[model samples]
Target: MSWKKSLLDWWGSAGYKKCSEKNRSVLKAAVSLMVVLFVLAIGVRAEKSVVIIDDGKELAVRTYAGTVADALAVKDIVLLNNDEVTPSLDSALVSGMAIRIDRATDVSISVDGRMLPVRTQCRVVGDLLNEAGVAPGPEDEVSPALNSAVTPGMNVVVARVVTKTEEKEAVVNFETEQKYTVNLPQGTTRIAEEGRNGTAQQIWKVKYKDGIEIARQLVSSKMIAPPVNQLVMVGSGLVVSRGGENIRYAEAIDMVASAYTHTGNNTSCGVAPHYGVAAVDPAFIPLWTKLYVEGYGYATALDVGGSIKGNRIDLFFESYNEAMRWGIRNVEVYRID
Candidate 1:
């Protein structure tokens, strides 16, 4: 106010009013030049803003534009398609206002063993997966958790989990059983009934990951078919054995047997008969061969008889009455070779 008023007062002075028009015009030009110089010295290149890149690099740019996009364009800063800008490009720019840009990256992802291509400007795995259009369930497992940071060439995997109960056919082994009987000869075995394999219907809870089985748990098992016990009868015959309980033999023959007495009788061996001697077929039991009569006592095959053909035998006793009582009976005689 004071300078303009002082200039106007000077212009209106008596000596100035009496001056020519050319002199007045020269004075006006000098005043305009002074004002222009003062404005330029105060405000030139002072209005600018700060821009920060993805890596935290800063750029100081001078621009007369009003918006963020215009400021970036004035500085020749180019942006990629996937890049992001904070405060938007059309936001108004003020002095010392900060601008930020985040560069995009290619993230690789594998969901349920399938590869997926995605691009994003996110920094963590959670954001990246969301951008890639993949979501994992509670039972599913992830190699890298959602909160894990994403980097270049990073690969993520998600495993699908499933559990189910399935019915299956399985086998239950049968047990072997043994029985002893005196009806059969010793040291021999007979399978009364042949053993057969059993069948069972089983239930199981199976777990799978990515369509592959991982674990199994038994839930309930019921026997659909019961196993039949095998029956085997073993011989425990009472036989003449100096070696206890071994009644095995090479061969046996079923024939009729008769009893005789000890006396000076002409026999096959041309010797006097004794109480423990027996006559048998020479082709069956050789002379002097030991013999054990069932329901009778031990004897020696010391003689042969012409009537003792095939499997016939004659056993000698101490008493004639005992021989008559023994009579004739069918017996299977074994030869101990």
Candidate 2:
């Protein structure tokens, strides 16, 4: 029989109906599996809401990425070598997740006479120094301040300051003092105690910055050896004896004595020129003053002569022969008050 005559015979047979029912059940199972697969794909691609804090700026983003790095890559954000990122790039992303990005800056640091270039993501100067492993001393000074905000291409200087005390020796000058006493002769002086210079210690506080001196202050000064004062003794009194009597004379002088007899004229004081009357320079001995002469006994200065100048005296005699006998000689004359 032909193939068309065979198909007509099967249409009337029970085997064809059983095969149709089995094919319908297989199509229903395929449709159910496809629906479940589509639902699972939608769940895996669901968008996640996230917050990104980039260099202190807030940004909201929704991504279907599976990891933090994937999310950032989808947002077209590029990270530099020195830039810092929170929640490492490999961490899985979650709904409502927060991401932080700290951008780095280039800066120069001057410390201890050296310059160093560095890149950091710190927010303040203090944090940058700590990151660089630079620990400043308590007395050190920092420019721009530790709490100041760090900026790109900024220059920071650290001045190394130090304080120290120093001790030094100095010379102390001596002083002089005078003492008046009657034991020393008049118009004479003597050094009773010698003078000597002493030593002193000076303490100073000094400050230095960057190996250079900045300031110095004298803290204290003390005498290490006291100076010895010079003591000088001066004379103020004199005494002498005259004509077997103790005379309290004020002054004495050695004078050249010349003798003169009666000149048959009155003296400069209008007194008679006789024994016990002497002629002297009024500048040396005032008129009417009492005087005691050695080897010539006592006399009164009652006259003045033209040649009787300083340290010269003329004595009166009873006769010219006696005047000739008494020539010129040095004699001590005392002025008695």
Candidate 3:
């Protein structure tokens, strides 16, 4: 049958006319059901919700209009060099889509007060400082020791020390009063002993002024040589004896601190070649005063030079040559300050 004739013939039939009211109602219901099915089949659809992880943060993109790229751009999610994403930007967004972005960045860290440039994925406090070449000095004090936890900003410091040894040479002048007896008489040459007199030592109290032998008053004197009085006949006018006889006389003693020659060059009254023994003339001279001798010229006594002590002077000679030359000569000394 023709499509139009079938539709008209069905409409004119008793099934259509006798039950027209009921049929009309049923037809209306059927038409409404068909429209509802059509609308349900193809209509505005709801977009899937997309979850993207970017820069360590989760971003939700709901109602994604187009592709994954469009979704990201729509959500204002920009991709950086170190950022990572799951289901790349080109992938289409689906329902409950999860996109993950791993973000990494170049960071400069200050380790123990020292600025260190490094690349790391660490987030804890202990691992950062070890990567940087930073160490603490032994004496340097830090807020936290080497084992302490490190943070973004920390401080450190260091300390140092130096040492030295020194040596110095000082001279101390000293003296002692001494008296010796001579057998020969004054102005007259007469050998009373008939032989040369041997040298004798008599200790005396000697005073020093500023490490110098100023005045030596004899405290006591003893005759080391025997008494010898020679009777000489004078032919011309009688010779008058101005000075007293060289008889047995006692003199006061004066002692001054003095240093002795440590070097075996034991020549009395001369400079010592070495720093053997030391003494000081506390009465007049201060310790460590330099001295020069006049009668016996040379660097004889170094005040407080450790030996040549008290009134007893140290006479310096060129060598042992003149040392023996001026062996026991009574000489005057001068202070050079």
lDDT of 1 at 317: 79
Lowest summed lDDT window (length 10), candidate 2: 242-251
Highest TM-score scorer: 1
Residue-wise lDDT of candidate 3 within 1-337, one digit each (tens)?
8755876687678767777677789976876786687675433245668777775677766773555777777877777653456777787666777777666444454434345555443343334435544443443333344455444444322222112222222222222222222222323343223323333334455543323454454444445554333333212222212134222211222333222334555333344544322234434444444433333322323334344445655443335654565455444433332
Total backbone collisions for each predicted model: 0, 0, 58
User: Tens digits of per-residue lDDT for model 2 on 1-337?
Assistant: 9754775677567755666777858855875786688886776589999999999998999989878999899989999869888899998888899999988899989998889898887889999889888888888999989999999999888889999899999888999987554556776788999999999999999998988899999999999998999998766455666566775554577899999998789988998788999999989888887888888888999998889998899999999999989999999987763
lDDT per prediction?
A: 0.76, 0.85, 0.45
How many clashing residue pairs are found in candidate 3?
A: 58
Q: Name the candidate, 1 or 3, with the larger TM-score value.
A: 1
Q: Cα lDDT of model 1 overall?
A: 0.76
Q: Which of the numbered candidates is closest to the native, going by highest lDDT?
A: 2
lDDT of 1 by residue, 278-301 (tens): 898878777877655666656678
